[model samples]
Target chain A: MSLSENLFYFLSFLAIFSALMVVFAKNPIHSVLYLILVFFALTGHYILLNAQFLAIVNIIVYAGAIMVLFLFVIMFLNLKKEGDISAKSVFVKVAGVVSGGLLLLVMIASLKSLEPYQLKADIKTDIGLVENLGKVLYNDFLLPFELASILFLAAMVGAVMLGKRESGERNF
Target chain B: MVEIITKIPLEYYIILASVLFCIGVIGVLIRRNALIIFMCVELMLNAVNMLFIAFSAYRGDASGQVFVFFIMAVAAAEVAVGLAIIVMIYRNTRSVDVGELNKLRY
Candidate 1:
């Protein structure tokens, strides 16, 4: 009925469609491209929710950097040859459907039973802005913030070591 | 157009995020490609980030936004390292099929 609603619906549809393609696409490159689409749609959703900083960062980091790496690696691997088994067995298909259906039912039932609470009209639109987020990051979440950086450093070293191909491996 | 956004309830965002999360789970289950599985993982993370942002916006608290920041950082690091590992696996085995990499089975 409204522009925001229309935008939400449009982005949501794109997100779901691209997500489906991420799974269904036969080529890994295409899968990465669809993932990029999903990330962009999510960035739009973030912007609509008043997280302008997140939207920009999401595009810069996800759609820009991470997806490029995904594409690069996919290309480097030369994995153009489709897998031998592209189709799933009927049993796995049934199990996947059943599990997803069950989870959906549970979520809907819980949400329905929980009464909605009225929120205060006071909004903090600047909460997600870079400056405000940075303040909170240092003030309230300082420990976790520092720890996360350490984790990233460790992950970086680990990845470099892992990706370095070993010289020899004799199969017994 | 700007006036219409104020009327939107936080529940709508939560519901949408839940749907996205579910789709991610389905993708993880039904697909075998390592890269796609990685994408599904990212989808799940994004869905959770949406929920956090929605709740933060509704409560007028900045904590949720901080968590989203942390989630983004972790996700970026994860994708970087995970993709590198996946590339290594592909090079070693020459296959990215999930079912084919079941060597850890007991």
Candidate 2:
């Protein structure tokens, strides 16, 4: 009945629709585009939840950086062939959808008993603010925060190694 | 004295995330393209992240948001490495389809 609730439903619809399109699109590039829309809808949800920092990060990392990388890969591969549309058998596709639907049914049924969790009286409501989370990230999660740099370094080196062409490779 | 987020129940979010996750699973199962499967995995990760954020907001805990941040970092690292591996496979096999690659030695 409220404006925020309306926005929430609209965004949820947008996200769900885009996600389905991402799976059903024949071209990988189209899928990437649809995925960007999905990420944008998620960002809207984050904003609605008042997680301002997470909202920005979701847009920057997912919609901006990751989707761009996916687009680049798709373009390089030129995977617009029609043959991919029929990649799986009809029976396999039906089974996949049926199993996925069963999983959804089970999760929703189990979630029906979830007791509502209220915010503690003493808990600060502004915990999602960048200032607060940054403080907590450095203070309590300092070790893990610092260690992520190592993970990034390893990933960078590994990507480079895996992507590089060997001597006399004759192919990229 | 809690900041009421919206009229929407937290269950709605949980259900939304679950549906997104199921869509990702179905995509992984039905799609033979390694790239599509990888994108579906990203979708699943995002579903979990959104759920985490919802819980964080509802419970007024910063830890959940911090965990989501860490998950994003790990996802970025994973995408970099996974895409590189996919590229190498594509280079050798000339196709990104998982069904075509039957042999482990290739």
Candidate 3:
């Protein structure tokens, strides 16, 4: 196998494994850490896809900033204990498994109908570069682009409002 | 050999991404921990992002990738607000179990 293939396989495996760990890890902090691993693996995949800019931004926004915020909240909350996980009824487990199995089956069946097509690596050198993305974001997607900041503003206000304590509440 | 795998059809990516998406759905269903469930949601989003990139590359257009950018933005906003809500729930109920938060089910 070529180096690129080997790299792809290795990175994909890492991504899947870390994603599983995010769900399996008991500690919230550990779960977040696993999520960081998943993001890093995704960045690797982005690089392989010739999206160098997306790769870096994925790291910066997800692994760097967002995870740090997650870590802060997790730590602030001090939710380290493995509290009672939940009352896991047999029916719930069965339902989860059956639904998941059905979804997978449907996806596989649909995918079987697609004709195979090869990708040429003839990527534009400008692909995923900051300048190119910026140009598109400003030109073609200008309106939605401007509106995103408003979305963030609304989210920030909502979060702060949610964090505020109720007048009668005793804790937190 | 390198070229061959690099040129593997878009179908492979679609199948792989679909599998990941299904698994994420399962995780969301099975896991009761609020944090784990959130991670599952992230997993599902990433799976979709994979599909988007695959299609973008296949179509020879960057627009799909641009949509991926929007998805990322929405995801970031979601994570920020979602985690805050989770924190608030935890603070109030001292619990993060989905089954416990039944006030809205009515």
Give the root-mean-square deviation of each candidate in angstroms. 2.2, 2.1, 2.4
Point out where model 3 deviates above 4 Å: A118-126, A170-172, B1-6
**Per-candidate interface DockQ score:** 0.58, 0.60, 0.52
What's the best-to-worst order under lDDT?
2, 1, 3
Any runs in candidate 1 off by more than 4 Å, and if so which?
A: A170-172, B1-5
* Winner on DockQ (1 vs 2): 2
Per-candidate TM-score against the hidden true structure: 0.93, 0.94, 0.91
Local error of candidate 2 at B77, Å?
0.6
lDDT of 2 at B3: 32
lDDT of 2 by residue, A1-172 (tens): 7678888899999999999998998888889999999999999888888889999999999888988898899888888796853468899999999999999999999986878755455655788889999999999999999999999999999999999999876574
- Error in Å for residue B55 of model 3: 1.7
* Model 1: colliding residue pairs: none
CAPRI quality of model 2: medium
lDDT of 2 by residue, B10-103 (tens): 8899999999999999999999889889999999999999999988987788999999999999999999999999999888878898987878
Tell how far residue A68 is off in model 1, in angstroms: 0.9
lDDT of 3 by residue, B1-101 (tens): 22323455677667768877877898898888887788789889988987887676565667777888888898899988999899988888887788898
Could you give candidate 3's per-residue lDDT for residues A28-91 as a string of tens digits? 8998998899889878777777666677878888888878988887788776676646756889
Name the better of 1 and 3 by DockQ.
Answer: 1
Question: fnat, candidate 3?
Answer: 0.43
Error in Å for residue A151 of model 3: 0.5
